[model samples]
Target: MKKFWNWKNQAQTENSPAERTLFLNGTIAEESWFDDDVTPQLFKDELNAGEGDITVWINSPGGDCVAAAQIYNMLSNYKGKVTVKIDGIAASAASVIAMAGKEVLMSPVSMLMIHNPMTIAMGDHAEMQKAIDMLAEVKESIINAYVLKTGLSRAKLSHLMDSETWMNANKAVELGFADGTLTRDNGGAENSNMEDAVEAVMFSSRAVNNALQNKISAKYGKQKQTVVQQSEIPAPETNERNVDALLERLDIIKNHI
Candidate 1:
């Protein structure tokens, strides 16, 4: 009898002791769209793999509201602790995902933008009115997420969402959008150069103004002058130095005659 090997079971058995952390990046679209294929599988695998804290880093511009809501719920309900780090920007649906984190962090330069949910539809007036009503309900769902995360009043949260609020890392911390600031350098040299360039421009502008003022003062101080001279008339005489001069005088006399 030959021994049979089970690779799938063997690998799972070996890896079960180690904790796994999955990374989710990019836009969140509709459940029937691209997100369904990627997010659900990843979530299922990560959830089943091991019992460990999951840290999710988000820098998305946001997409389908429904997909974002689903992903948010999944993370929020996960048994293990979830931490979210916003390394760059988290806008629209991305912001909703951030709310799922038990502890949220944001880099100094990272930003968050939130707004009312929206969609386009073409139909009769009644159908259009229904679409408007649907959008209002979706907006409420989004507002609920923010209210849950921030613990702010629903009315206040709804107002901010309606206006499409933008929050920096510090503002995010203050408003409870982010729990705290993360210590991550986004490369300091570029920022230093930008500051230096601004200073140089300001100094150059001052130098130009000083030069213009000096020129204006100098123009007022300087006196204009006009000089003229009349020379005494000298008697006309023929040149006796060379034969060429004599020939030239003879040609002039001939022409005059």
Candidate 2:
């Protein structure tokens, strides 16, 4: 079975602290956790082998929510401080694991995404309902993790998940998904030119959507006010309603990407 995590021990230096580092890269738990018992045992053994602070470097698209949940629990209960550093993208189930961190930091160009839990089910109406109920419970459990880390209300977090929110580093920090952005002064020297190039490409899609939203709002704001004043019509209710609907549609479009 392919391991999802890699471990390394860094010796203490004159200027830096000694800590174990774990890399969680690529798709998490590409193999099902329930397939065999060895994987979890090996992961737990490696995690418990050392003492002192540990830093987890995450760059995953996310997979296998059950595996992520087990990892999160282990890290949360560990004796040493757990620091999570997102160096690329942490989305879906990976975002749940990130909440186990005592301090979560994202690279300036890193991305984090959260969405409602999903599953495949094929059966009669009763089975379909059971699947839906299961997913709802799973999403609630995931929200519990987010609530603990971000202090965001369950309703707000649920809405974000419903919309499949994607956040950049600054936004992540603002929303409490991350403590802060990593920087050279903060011992983050791993970000290189190549990573920046990749970030540029990945971030462009979101940038365009944001720009479009702003442009539409700005152009319509003035027009809406002008129409109301010229016609003496009670346009606020209608215009506001339509604007909200339009923005919701835009969000739906953006989320699909």
Candidate 3:
């Protein structure tokens, strides 16, 4: 767990009337970026702040992939609904973080870019091959996240990533990268269906749910394992039923349009 910025301290010293208490902002490319100790703490504090939706403000050029992944997981597994707002740009690993949000909201001028994972490696031909294989595996994992969030075809998503696609707010929403654009006038009504999808996804994969639990326990340094019992797991049939119901709802909405 990393806490890169002391957002609370900054807020106290430089209070802004327009700032929401739950809004968090950080730059991934700046020096001292991705401070492991500070970023996680801020996220924890916000998560524990009571029962309500959270808005995460991102304006990053992207940095440490591991750190970004951890933070993204934390937000995704949180009990409350999480909305991500890309205020400026979310590139590379930052794009992964954006996908973790329950409902992604972007400013009209915001941008998002995604590309294949990259890493520096020093090794022989065999070792280099291994590195390449690992990178491919990692890319698949990242692509799964995007597919789960957007319900987009894997082939299309892979093509976009390969092209290092850059998306504007309208394009993002059209492509399912974002739920919608945010208005300066007010924070609009939260979407109940989006909230349900977030909760459903948390319970959909046993591995993901377990990983999240382990991360939380490690964060608190608790020896006790928080195991989700088999009976608690959502059945595959139930998931299919939910999806069918969602599709029906969408069809009804379309009829009204």
Candidate 4:
């Protein structure tokens, strides 16, 4: 709720004209606690306050996907230039919001993370399948944003999301997720309270195959090793008698010689 976002002018001095800059901290939510008053509409209202370029500073562990999607769309639709600066960390849903910026800048030490949308469901077999289908569609939607922003192939973006990829400023720029790294000197455009935005959050990144295998093992127990038994067959009786007869004839021939 209150910890969601902070909107402020980027420039503080009277000599410098007011510049619209939004500092997005903590988690992104569909609505603030209680009602829908503190969501995308509120953000748009704040954005309407000033003219010129809009700069957004994000440092969040990320939250609701729907909210992030709405904010992303709004920023993408904005007429003025939208600049996003990541001062701490933007992961998961926050990463999607980051893509809306016309120019994305990351602090040298900041991080960006992208991962598949996760959800919990309670259902029968058919309902489980439906959940799977819905997740597939959601994953596709997320992939679209990443593909448009990075110009990376959908397959590559999918693979990256599968692994819950994490990127630093330079790496983010290299991957085209960010335009450049921010270099702050004498408190220019950097967040004044950057330390307050820091968060320790881990991505749910255990290898899916490995996890499935472990679950299967736990359910069905490890497969038992098969043992092959060898058996010896005696020579055929007819063949043995024929060999004896041949040896007897050879002995008689030798005796006659």
Candidate 5:
């Protein structure tokens, strides 16, 4: 089985802080960590192998919520400060892991998304109902982590999740999902800033839908205008003759009546 995380030790320098860099680059766990005893233990051992702060770089579309929850618990319980930096996108289960960071920073171009928990069940009506209940409980559990970090109301968070909200760096900071935005310094080093130069910007499925609608309207609008212009043009001489013939027939019929 493949592991989902990589660890790198960075030497303490006078100009920078000493920290271990952990990269979570793909799916949370390609294979279930709970299935075997060895992998989880190995992950814990490596995490505890060093001292000082930890810098976690996350870039994942997310997978295996349970595995992500376990990772979150481990990072939250660590002795050193945990700082999470999103270099790409963190969606679904990966977003839960991001909540474990004491200070979460996002790249200016990175994205974060949150949505309701989902599962597949194969069984009768009772089993389906059970799955539904289980998913609701799981959603609540995930919300606990977000609430702790963002201090946002549960109702608001739930609505966001229901809508599958996506947020950019500034929007994440504004919503308290992130503490700030991460940028490169003059020394070609990464730096986190609380005050991003750009204002908070929100990106959602609704906005995408609206833009698509606008494009469709613009595309069809021209065609509709062309049809209207053609309709307004005077009728063909053949059509005029046909109309005159009909009018003469009507007059003859009236005279006979």
Candidate 6:
């Protein structure tokens, strides 16, 4: 619940458009082995606060997959057009979220990265195979988001993901990941063509695991009643392996939230 990506609305005048701003900075899920995260529920609440065109600012390393998926759906479902501006980098799950925007813009030196989904498992071959299948489907679902926005073919997107593609502002625009590079002046105002004010970066949870779980459930719901109950079969319990195993599972689970 308490992660860095706080959603806040800026004050607007009576005649100004009811523009809402979203800041996505940091990991996408709560328990990040690398850094902190931004949970999905809080994001949903922040996203629904206003009723006008929205702009999101993102700078993140990326985290949970399902959390990013749900956020993407929410933004795509919004009535108003959405614009995304990348300041630093939108890697992995963060890049997926960027695809939801109708117009995506990037700072001249900013970057975007995409790659395959990852998970950890300790079960026998059957369970391990299930994990692999789940990850593959996750990758496919991510590509769906990209294809919808960029009009890229499934084969090409898959290849890009496999390669862990990293693109710069111009390349992103050329590839359709971004509409254009943001044009600003010494006074920090957007060039004559840009009408909105630049949003400040806000340093941005555990809900990611929940979202990942939900995603897996939706795909494998037939297994929910059985698996959610019996999937906890004990692993060989020991001091070191137990800790490592739990951490790995957490690494994989937080994306659902």
Q: Pick the winner on lDDT between candidates 2 and 5.
A: 5
Give the whole-model CA lDDT for all candidates, comma-separated. Answer: 0.67, 0.84, 0.66, 0.77, 0.85, 0.75
Sorting all predicted structures by TM-score, with the top scorer first, yields: 5, 2, 4, 6, 1, 3
Error of 2 at 198 (Å): 17
Best by TM-score: 5
Candidate 3 is scored at a TM of 0.60
Clashes of 3: 9
Model 5 C-alpha lDDT per residue in residues 191-245, reported as the tens digit of each score? 5664536666665676577678667656665665687688997534453333334
Please state the error at residue 231 of candidate 5 in Å: 13
Clashes per candidate, residues 3 or more apart or on different chains: 0, 0, 9, 0, 0, 23
lDDT of 2 by residue, 1-257 (tens): 78879988745567665679999999988976856578888899888877789999999999988888999999999998999999999999999999999999888878999988988999999999999999999999999999999999999999888767888887787788888777674654532323333332223344567688788877887777788899997854433444546788878999996
Against the true structure, candidate 2 reaches a TM-score of: 0.72
User: What TM-score, computed on C-alpha atoms, does each candidate reach?
Assistant: 0.62, 0.72, 0.60, 0.69, 0.75, 0.68
* Decoy 5 TM-score against native: 0.75
What tens digits encode model 4's per-residue C-alpha lDDT throughout 145-201?
998999999998888888888877777877789887776678675423232343322
Residue 9, candidate 3: C-alpha displacement in angstroms? 10
Q: Per-residue lDDT for 170-228 in model 3, tens only?
A: 77777788887755655553322233222211112334565776676465433221232
Model 4 lDDT, full chain set: 0.77
Better of 5 and 6 by lDDT: 5
Q: What's the lDDT for residue 18 in model 6? A: 55
TM-score of 6: 0.68
Off by over 4 Å in 6: 31-39, 186-257
Better of 3 and 5 by lDDT: 5
Best by lDDT: 5
